[model samples]
Target: MKLATLTLAATLVTGAAFAAEIAPSDVQFDEYGAVDQSLTGTPGNPEEGEKIMTNRGLGNCVACHEVSALDYAAFQGNVGPSLDGVADRWNEAELRGILVNAKKTYDGTVMPSYYRVDGFVRPGNAYTGKAADDSFGPLLTAQQVEDVVAFLGTLEYEE
Candidate 1:
């Protein structure tokens, strides 16, 4: 029992240390609310972005927005607009800004800022019900935001 407890403690400590190492996002929005610069200086993988968007524990974007490409997800939400031909409507920079922080683009939007860290009213650690500490980072990592942007870019109108 002692060994198990020690192992769990060690794992938690390691995880916390890793989480603390995540640097805050440096993305800057343009006057048009577009993030023309890449947050991580790395191009995102659309495949990984798709996984993040669909996963309930992760992005769970379907909870608020409907994506016809993600038809496999039941009960895609309607709170947000249907993401059909989103790429045709917005460019990559604009998509990046929206994924990083939608309110910057559209005021009064209910969309959560995936890459912002400082402005939340009562931020908490993931599912812990504990007030977030310095170790608490943005809702999504910089790369994760890029990935989602890449994924959204793929949602072209399937005509």
Candidate 2:
């Protein structure tokens, strides 16, 4: 029994450390809200991004926007503009900013920050302490942000 308790305690500590390492603690940007300095060598994958876009627990982007690449989604939100030609409108860095936090580009946008971890006035209990759910932890990892950006980068108004 004591050994089991010790093992569990060790596991919890290790888990917390891992989470702390992955959660982004700060938001960064360059002029035009385009450069996502956070994105490093972790290459984005459009295929994986499509899955995240429709995932309610992940990006859940379909909950608030329409994307041409995500036609199979049963319900695409209309609150935001269509992403048919998003790439044409914005470049890679711009899309990164939008995906990371649209507020950087559009001040009053309802889009939540996928990779921002600070300045939340009053977060919920579920997001109060845990590294995976904290006011100083981003909603999505850096890789996830890059993946989504890569997918959006492919969209363009085919005229």
Candidate 3:
């Protein structure tokens, strides 16, 4: 009787442990019933996308990456991963997450938060608080971000 009880208890504990290890599926629907999936189905124009990619006022992707064999633009840093085949490695949502707020997923990251709307302290003028505001504040607008995401979709590896 003691042996049977111990075996049953052990089995129950093992099963519970296995159940605890299970994780939720990646894709999830929001409160508005919109299916949150990566930017897989969107079509993009490489030329227009290239403009955004290089534009310092917009995507500014070239600031940290060497994309395309274009003209001589200076100050391209190789600090981050080379975006040669970013589309092959990450889906749209993942890219969006990186663009939106890298710090949420990775703490102590040098990457600036782009899409964060709340909890941001407003800056004072030169007399009161002379320090410059977050100069790296979002280079691209929301629509521009969507456009960039569309463009990044095209950078797939030839597999």
Candidate 4:
């Protein structure tokens, strides 16, 4: 009985620790729509970021942008500009802002705001706005957004 109780306690503590890691969804943008703050107050892992950016069930950045560093990915779309040398074009905060909400940076952009929750039309429901059963939330976690930013920062011109 003591062992079971100890295990349960450990699980709860660990779960809480992980839950606290997620950054706040209320993001603040600059005049240029750049997020100048770190979402997690810690540097993200570039390797993990790369995985999240390419994963179809996750960031799925390849669906609209082509990343030369991710040439292994198939059927990369061109709707957005190439991210080959994005690191040279934008700073870390700018990259973070773009990921958090591209529409804030470039109006009329089809990019989905990955971390925004408020100001959404008929939020807290499915995308079709017909199903109230599905609870809509930030597409990616705070840590995931930081991770993608770290990865994008590495996409400098290779030439």
Highest lDDT against the true fold, candidate: 4
Task: Highest TM-score: give the candidate number.
Answer: 4
Model 1 stretches astray by more than 4 angstroms: 1-25, 123-133
Sorted by lDDT (best first), the order is 4, 1, 2, 3
- Alpha-carbon lDDT, every model: 0.81, 0.76, 0.57, 0.83
Report model 3's TM-score to 2 decimal places: 0.56
Per-candidate TM-scores read 0.77, 0.74, 0.56, 0.77
Give the alpha carbon lDDT tens digit for every residue of 23-57 in model 4.
43557799998998777766788999999989999
Backbone Cα, N, C clashes tallied per candidate:
0, 2, 1, 0
Compute the lDDT of residue 53 as modeled in candidate 2: 87
**lDDT per residue, candidate 2, 44-131, as tens digits?**
8988888888899999988888986678898899998888888899988888888877787888888988877655655776554455
Per-model C-alpha RMSD = 11.8, 11.1, 14.8, 8.0
Minimal lDDT window, size 10, model 1 = 123-132
Please provide, for model 1 over 19-55, each residue's C-alpha lDDT reduced to its tens digit, 9 standing for 90 to 100: 4323444567898789887776567899999999989
Model 3 residue 119 lDDT score: 40
What's model 4's overall lDDT?
Answer: 0.83
How many collisions between residues are there in candidate 1?
0
